[model samples]
Target: MNPDQLIEFLGILEKLKCNTRHNWSTSGRQESVAEHSWRLAVLAMLMEEDFPELDMNKVIRMCLIHDWGEALTGDIPAFLKTEADEKTEAGAIESLLEKLPVSLASGYLAMFKELSDLTSEEAILVKALDKTETLIQHNEAGSETWLPLEYELNLTYGDEVCRHFEKTQQLRDKVREHTLKIMEEEVRGHREK
Candidate 1:
């Protein structure tokens, strides 16, 4: 293993600390991509019981690196991402992988590709958890980020989840209900005033 190459890759990952998500945290500060990934990884572990057949370790690793591309491409909001943006992110992932040694790079890149393609049950579970995590955060934080959207939630993730995981569906529905209730209260308060 090339220590220098590994260090360089680690340094690039540090960018995730500054790449902020569109949604604010419960503390009212914009959460970074690194913070988002960490929580998602934790969620993957916590939700492992729901999918006993899948590899929880692989799910956790996917959660950790799924957003590593954002370390190079920056955190683009799911709703605003375009096909072109995805292409850009794919390229960024490849570029980042090129910086690591062959042994580490091949494994990490394969994991990234597997998750990107939803090639395995573990990958699919991780993907669902990723979306669930965002929605969970929004519900917990009462983020107004989704208030102006014409849809109930961001299309990029909202539609993709729940198709594969029952627990994900439950959480998605809960978040939707929570968001609607919050909006209704705000509207009613405005009318009363």
Candidate 2:
């Protein structure tokens, strides 16, 4: 790509740094889309050893770009986002990809297709990690940040995808255990109050 195209693409990605997700940080503020993607990529990197059969690089790339569409549409909480919202985000992704050179755009389009279809092991791993990352963020955000519905969501949100792999399923079990502990603590605290 030319320098101008590179600059334009970088400029567009900057929006991800500014677009906040529904989840809050432990520091008492909303997390940005970029922050979530960065951590998700890092999480995939950290899991490289555990998933040697898959392409960790592809999984990392998926984590990084999975939400690039949110840079345009902003984040709709997973629980509240409808099928229409998903289509809109997909359109936004297409629009963004159009700005790139044919070579780059084609590669990203393939990745997006694989991700949306969840047909490959790498794609499935990324999806599972994405949901795991969100659940971990919610737990870190503390109970006060949670909506009433999240009490249940925190426990059940990623069960299906995580179940696709034994390791991911084990990870989900640990996360669910933590969610249960948090709920139990909340209940005990309320009773004390």
Candidate 3:
């Protein structure tokens, strides 16, 4: 891609830095979509040894671009997102991809399709890590930041996806344990108040 094309493509992605997710950070601020994607990619990288047979690079790539659609639509929490919302995001992604060179656009279009299909090991790992990352972030955020349903959602959100890999399942189990602890502490604090 030429300098101008690269800059234009990046300009579209720049919105991800400004797009806020539903979850708050541990430091008590709304988390940006970029922040979540950055950490999710890191989380994928951290599992390299655990998934030696898989393409860690592809998993990392998936993690990075999984939410690029959100740059256009902002975030719609999983619970609230419907089929129409997904179609809208898909359309947004296609529009954004059109700005890129043919080679790059086609490659990304394939990657996005692979991610949606979730048939490959890399796709499955990325999807599992994506859910696990969200649960971990929710656990990190203060209980006061949580909606009542999130207490349960955090415990159960990634169970099916995480079940695809033993390591991810273990991680999900640990996060659920932490979620329960947080719930108990919040309840006790409420009673004390």
Q: Between prediction 1 and prediction 3, which has the larger lDDT?
A: 3
Candidate 1: minimum summed lDDT over ten consecutive residues — where?
150-159
- Write the residue-wise lDDT of candidate 1 on 1-193 in tens digits: 5688678778999999999998788888889999999999998888878878888888898899998889988988887899999999989999988887788789999998898788998888887778878877776676454556733564335646566777778776776777677778768888999
lDDT of every predicted structure (CA atoms): 0.81, 0.94, 0.92
Q: Residue-wise lDDT of candidate 3 within 1-193, one digit each (tens)? A: 9999999878889999999999999889999999999999999999899999998998899899999999999999999999999899999999999998888999999999999888798999999999999988988896889898887788789799899999999999999999999989988999999
Using Cα atoms with residue i matched to residue i, what is each candidate's TM-score against the true structure?
A: 0.90, 0.98, 0.98
Could you tell me which 10 consecutive residues in candidate 2 have the lowest summed lDDT?
Answer: 175-184
Q: List the residue pairs that clash in candidate 1.
A: none
List candidate 2 stretches off by more than 4 Å. none
Descending-lDDT candidate ranking: 2, 3, 1
How many Å off is the CA of 114 in candidate 2? 0.4
RMSD of candidates 1 onward, in order: 2.1, 0.7, 0.8
Superior by lDDT: candidate 2 or candidate 3: 2
Which pairs in model 3 have colliding backbones? none
True-vs-predicted CA distance for residue 33, candidate 1, Å: 0.4
